[model samples]
Target: MKRMFTLLALVWAGSSMGADWQVTQSDSISAYVLCHQGDCPVRTAKVFDLPVAVPMPARVSDSAAKPVTMHSSTSVRFALASARLSQTEKAKLKAFLKRHRDARRFLVVGSTDQIGKKRFNETLAYKRGMAVAVFMRANGIPNRNIKVDSRCCIEHPPSTNPDARRAVISINE
Candidate 1:
């Protein structure tokens, strides 16, 4: 009879406090405990983003690639003393224009090393900047929407930075 009374007391204690509250607790605690040795697979969740406002193309083409979302600033590099765009740089510029088709304006600022004659460096910078501008025109941007800035050349001390012979492209959306 004494043992039965003790068992009854225990049951009453549990009934008054915490039998159901624990069942509703998160399973993440147990999952976390299972990862003590870092072998457990982590759970993942999918994310959804808001939609974009891309306009319809003026011409329908079956061969045109889909447009991807990309950055607002990019730099296309050139060889030393050269104003020409390499095939890789051409691809980069093409992809950039594709991604930012709705941009209002584009700025191409050309830069060159300070080791050349001031007039020659400025001329090379202008040619580099204009090359990018011309590419933009070919890709459908109007001449009014593109501005080439060549004043960025030979103004600063020369450095080994690879971007010294590059055209920086910035977009105004």
Candidate 2:
């Protein structure tokens, strides 16, 4: 009898807590933002925090956002002076693009390290961006569905976090 009453009391407490209204909850999108070489100090790492929530925004989709696809250089290095992906990095790009082959369109946006000349880095970034698109096309993805663009390196440098070297690919059906 005592044990039963204790269990009932616990259940009642749980129910009472559930009756409380929830006002605001923290939410976030998890992504790796690479720090380009020159923009952030060489060989230094910066950390940041992002939060996320369940039942994501109605306007945005990709329910499986938890496991983000990531590919990084051996060190916090750049391919040219600014771009991140190298020849070894190329294989991961192929796989990353292949994962979203069924999508109607894939956007490949490239970024750069803050070290090089702007015009050169911009062109290089575009090439890196196209490099991914080309990989997708070569692997049987339709050309129409792949879009590439490069926005130079950091317009505003992020902390020296190596994750800041990242180029991101988003797939949309």
Q: For residues 45-129, could you state the per-residue lDDT of candidate 2 as single tens digits? A: 6567756657856677678767654342222124445454576666766666556555677777777766668787778777767
| lDDT on C-alpha atoms for all candidate structures | 0.77, 0.60
Give lDDT for model 2.
Answer: 0.60
**84: Cα error in model 1, Å:** 1.0
lDDT: which candidate is best?
1
> RMSD per prediction, one decimal?
15.1, 21.1
Which regions in candidate 1 have their CA more than 4 angstroms from the true location? Answer: 1-71, 152-159
- CA lDDT for candidate 1: 0.77
- What's the residue-level lDDT of 91 in candidate 1? 98
Backbone clash pairs in model 1 (N, Cα, C under 3 Å; residues 3+ apart or in different chains), count: 0
Tens-digit lDDT string for candidate 1 (3-102): 6896567656655754321222365542112122234345457588969979987976666676654448998988888989999999999998898888
Clashing pairs in 1: none
